[model samples]
Target: MGDFIDVEQLYDLAMTYSVKLLQALLLLIIGLIIIKRLTSFLRKRFERRKLDPSVRSFLLPGISLSLKILLGISIATMLGAEMTSFVAIIGSIGFAVGLALQGSLANFAGGLLILVLKPYKVGDYIETKDHSGTVNEIQIFYTTLDTPDNKRVIIPNKELSNSSLINYSINKTRRVDFKFGISYDDDIKLVKDILNNIVSSHSLIIQEPEPKIVIGEHGDNAIIFYVRVWCKREDYWTIFYELQERVKLDFDQNNINIPYPQMDVHVSNS
Candidate 1:
């Protein structure tokens, strides 16, 4: 009889633990679903706010991880596990992992600075060191660029943040500077008039700032005329190539001489 009573108590104990375990599992499953939905909601909110891509990329993962950690703690508590020791162990592990990833930590910090400071953003044409391209993506550790020739470049965020970079797309307009050389004997007035006409005729060039055509310098073989014009950033390359071709063609048609280096050497033997 006593053995039967003991068996009944044992079964009750096992049943109680089984129920708690199932409850813990259910809580974990529901918690994960909530975390996923919450993270997605936050991501959409960030997109609506027009947050920087880098910031959004860094933040979403962090939010998910933080929520999961909290959920894990809650699950452990529900399972009758001690919280203090579990948190301490987690902290120790995190510290050890952080110590092992110093370089990665620096990159993470650099990425944060880039997002906050707004040095460059996705779709911006940027040049850093010797690499120049359009920024395609910015992540926690690297920035991806699409080069003019369709090459993909991956630059480390740490190096990019520390170095100087030129963001060419920051402004809506750009100035195109061209230097043309003509023979020293060429008529200065005629050259200026020809350039002015070309500038006025070009549909891409802006007239508000006014195109500048002036004698810049006198070289050994030619006179240099500096030409400056403003155009929309999108039209810069087109205008540059067109201007050069048109100027050369017009100069040739008008009988203007573009001087090249020539040496007249005479030797006398006595």
Candidate 2:
């Protein structure tokens, strides 16, 4: 009878431990789900606040991951588990992982720098390392650019922030300069007048600067005229394309000859 009682007590103790283990697991799962939902809610709230997209992308993911880890640790403690040893183990592992991912960490830091610096905004036209494109999106590791040829290029934030960046849309207006050459025989005054008339007639051209046209140079076979105009940034492309077309047509109608390269070839017969 004494041996049977001891066996029964051992069995009851095993059952109690198993039940506690199961409850701990359930608590962990519920905690994770709640963290997920709360993180999502915070993200949406930040978005509604019109936070910078680049900032929000990294901020939300980082905060959520941190919160989930903390909650999991809390749940573990409630299950009467010793956490100090586990935390020490995680700390050592994290140090090793961080060393292995140093380059990725550098990129993430660069991305944060870009978000804070505000060198260029979304939809801004920029040139970096000879690659010209419009910024489509900025992310934690990389930035997306849409090229003029409709190509999507992903550039690492590390390179982007480190390199020189040229932003074209920084100002509300931009200057467009065009040089046209005419036959030396054409009157310089007449050429200037034609360019001036065209500039003034263009609707997109800004009048404050008062477009300037002057004789630039006298080439071997032609005379050059420099035409400078200013227009709004949004109208830059339209003004550029239209001015080229109109200048060619007007020059032709006025009998102005844009010089073309001519080579004199000599053949010798022996």
Candidate 3:
């Protein structure tokens, strides 16, 4: 009789645990389906917001993982696991891992900030203090750039987020600045007229702002004229080089002397 009672008790315990395991399995499957649908729904909404591909790639997985973790906790509780102890263990593991990869975590956060805020996007021509290039790819930990000379440069995303960069391609039009210095003896009016003519003749230059031509400074060797012209961003380099060449040629024809640095010394016999 004692043996039979022990067997019956063991059988009841086994059946109870089996039922809980089945319930846990069912919950896991249902939770996964819900997570999938939710992820899909969010992706479509992100597309409507026109979020960058990098941002979506980083965010979707994070969201899915977080949801699955919560589902796991729920399933574990259903399976008779103590919630407090389980959460505490997970927290301890996470804290240790975070400490081990602190720098990586910081960079990861920086990349996320960059992707969401968009100070500069891929395809933008950006200039940093030590680097200038066209952005080719923006990733979670780093970014790739193709320089004007066709060199590929990889930069840490943390640096990009922390530093100030100039995005030349962000605007449709950009102002090209030029400083031309001529001998103080040259006719200021003639120089101004020549600059105005050159700027007006350029087909790429925009007219709404009107070119600025004015005497800027009187230096030891020359008088400077500060010239500014607005042009389409695509035409900026072309207009810049063309204007310099035209100015030099026109100045030569008009006998305007572009001054160079010189030293004047008086020799004394003492």
Task: Give the per-residue Cα lDDT of candidate 2 at 121.
Answer: 69
lDDT of each: 0.92, 0.86, 0.90
* Residue 94 of model 3, lDDT score: 91
lDDT tens digits by residue: candidate 3, 1-270:
999999999999999999999999999999999999999999999999998766775678778989999998899889877989998988999999999988778888888888879888878999997999998877667778899999999888889889899999989999999999999789999999999999898899999888899888988789999999999999999999999999999999999999997789999998
Residue 1 displacement (Å), model 1: 14
Worst 10 residues of 2 by lDDT: 52-61
- Whichever of 2 and 3 has more lDDT, that candidate is 3
Residues 1-270, model 2: lDDT tens digits: 999999999999889988988988888888888888988898889889988766776577778778877877776777776889778878998899899988777788888888889888678899998688998888777888899999999888888888899999889999999989999888777778888899999989999888888888888888888888999999999999999999999999999899999999999996
Which candidate ranks first by lDDT, i.e. highest? 1
Task: Arrange candidates by lDDT, descending.
Answer: 1, 3, 2
Best by TM-score: 2
lDDT per residue as tens, model 1, 28-116:
99999999999999989999999877678778887898899899889888888788988898899999999999888888888889988
Model 2: CA > 4 A from native: 1-36, 71-81
Clashes of each: 0, 0, 0
Better of 1 and 3 by lDDT: 1
